[model samples]
Target: MTNGDDEGAAGARNRTVAVDGETFVYRRFGGTGSETVPPLVLLQHFRGNLDSWDPALLDVLAADREVIAVDLRGVGESTGRVRDNVTDMARDTIAFTAALGLRQIDVLGFSLGGHIAQELALLRPRLVRRLVLAGTAPRGGPDFHNWSDDLFDTSCLDNPTAETFISLFFSGSTDSVKSAWAYLARAGARTGDQDSATTLEVRDAQLQALMEWAIPDSSKLERLAAITQPTLVACGDNDTMMRTSNSNLLADRIPGAQLRIYPDSGHGFLNQYPVAFGEHVRKFLGQ
Candidate 1:
């Protein structure tokens, strides 16, 4: 195991494993509690690392079940060339799960991770015991550009500024924006190491994938019904990038899928309101 300094204040335990010729690092919490509880697998959004997830949120969820958050390929401590699409990342996820010997785990994904989660559930329905998708869409389409110019222009990848990244995550009215900025600043301060090449490659691959990939059509929607696992679809009412309506549509389409909407929240609602998000997730996974 390649060990690094523990981000102690966060209370996250990090571990690295070899999966499909890559070194994938994951942070785990609460898995050691008891054998009766099932483990939860967490998937982060685009360019997100394990540290991107709130440690407090994982701690809360761990009270009832073990929580595992992964840093996807080409991100954080995970190794591999930059992936071109969600499919590659999804494959990496499957490989990681298999390598870790995790069977029938509850799965949760947010934003870009949500997209990959959907693909994973569809591809390997038996591996997932339950599913939760936050601020995610079934298929990327015209909705990708639904955000206001102000919001779109504030994207961190396009212009890497502390303010731009912070604004892209949550609504201006969110009180946690300061904390979000602090987190981003800490993450940014650790940037530009030997892993800089990996970050750039990942960014380029993501851009290329976004430009060329088209979401599978409504035909793929039929597969959601085939998924026997209990599924939850959630989004913030104020989500601008992916409309709440899209989440509703997904919930309505999938058999027995539950939908929840956070009031006055945006795309990054999970991080914006970790306590509420963790509560909802805990209940759903516990069921």
Candidate 2:
């Protein structure tokens, strides 16, 4: 695998894989534990590249098993026409894994990435051994489209600044605000080899997919029954984008799936409480 040195303390190598002529950029972190375990693959939030991830969470997760965080096609360093729906994105994810010869893996999908991860597991159940769905909900239901027009407007604005992220991802609580700033500082620590910002075209395409996923559909609810893989569902009590209720719905529908609700946090709760969240994830995946 083509690799680069750990740009920050995350101890991850920036790498890329060619899958069906499309180049998928990913960061590969070699965990300090057993190599026989399946790699934990991360799918990013809407409009977020690898750089948007918290090194705190990645480093903690990487301590026990190999981890790979990727940029979807047409986002950041990946090369391809951006997909318009979750299914297509899931197909691309499968192809990306196939290119790397990864037979079994665990998946952690955040926000829109969680939607794609659900589709991926349903499309190829055996490929995913376990699943982590954070700040997201299953497809379907009118309320599932609870995100307001302004939230979308602000998030998709050209050249989003730290202020935009603070508003979109965190609760208004003082602690949450402090957490957001600290998370941003760590996530932005890699000054060299930073990824390009996602374009308007990519954002529009993702928004289209999200809207479609929100349409009420019984089939989507039915598909939840098919997700027999061990699942962990996490969300903040105040996730305005996806909403906290959606997480409850997922936990209630998916048999044996565990749910975690972090108080006084928003969509970026994982970043808000990385140590606690990471430890919970470690225990879940280790089971």
Candidate 3:
């Protein structure tokens, strides 16, 4: 990836890396990490792209280390078929980092991106130094096979408006709703040279992967034990998407993993409490 001149996430321009005949678009912001800190690879949530990341969170996390968020294969400006399974998606992420010559890096994955992060750590343990799993669950995690009957109902929609995000990612509390709006306002700051909107095809492909991962199978939970790197499992106390208990399960299953749950928040806890969470992460990874 070419060096970016912009200083923050909102101003960071796009960069590309061609690997395996496919071009992947990514944004690398923040200056180099201080001391031994490595670059942090950010994985976007489901139906989200490079631009979908919360700028405030990125800016805070980048205060001490470089941050790189990439559009998943076949999503945003990236070119390729969207993989229908999390494992293949993880492989694509591996290829993207390998092409960039990243031998070892820290990772922060949100929602579906967290699923990919877990897979990445397990797929190539030595490649990742530290991990942060936000608003996500392990395979066969809580509420498995019962996410919601209308999951695809929203999936097929062409526009996921601000309200849609609020309903799904935020809690019903008055303060949480206000936080949602604030996060939305910050997220909209990036305008020029923006990444492409997520298409229905990419949505459906990721949905299929989610369904496959949500299938009822107790054996799948055991796979998380393979993750050997230092990890932080985080989410809101009222996560309707992945369920709060799932984050607890992830903390339990992953050896020596730390768990943090923000009260009065929902799936978008990191965005809601970006400052606290960002510092939490900075401290965790800095160690």
Clashes of 2: 0
lDDT head-to-head 2 vs 3, winner: 3
User: What is model 1's C-alpha RMSD?
Assistant: 4.1
RMSD score of candidate 2 (Å): 2.2
Give per-residue CA lDDT, model 3, range 182-233, as digits (tens).
9888888777769998898898899888878878677998998899899999
TM-scores for the candidates = 0.84, 0.94, 0.95
lDDT score, residue 223, model 2? 78
**Comparison by lDDT, 1 against 2, better one:** 2
Winner on TM-score (1 vs 2): 2
Candidate 2, poorest ten consecutive residues by summed lDDT: 1-10
Q: What TM-score does model 3 achieve against the real structure?
A: 0.95
The lDDT for every candidate, in the order shown, is: 0.70, 0.86, 0.87
Candidate 2 per-residue lDDT, tens place, 1-287, comes to 32223433354656888978889988877553233468888999988888888988887787767788888889988889899999999999999889878888899999999999999999999999999999998899447574678887787787888999899999989999999999988987776567777888888889888888988776778778889999999999999888899899888888899999999999999999998998999999999
Q: Which stretches of candidate 2 lie over 4 Å from their true place?
A: 1-11, 32-36
lDDT, candidate 1, 1-287, per-residue tens: 11222332155556789987888877665644233345678887666666566655665676656677887777877777868887887888899889888776788988778877888887788888889989887764435643456754554254366566566666667565765665455444432221222265666676565433335455656666776778989888877766677788779877899999877667777766677888988888777
Question: How does model 1 fare in lDDT?
Answer: 0.70
For residue 262, model 3's alpha carbon misses the true position, in angstroms, by: 0.5
Clashing pairs in model 1, backbone N/Cα/C closer than 3 A: none
What 10-residue stretch in candidate 1 is worst by lDDT? 189-198
Q: For candidate 2, what is the TM-score? A: 0.94
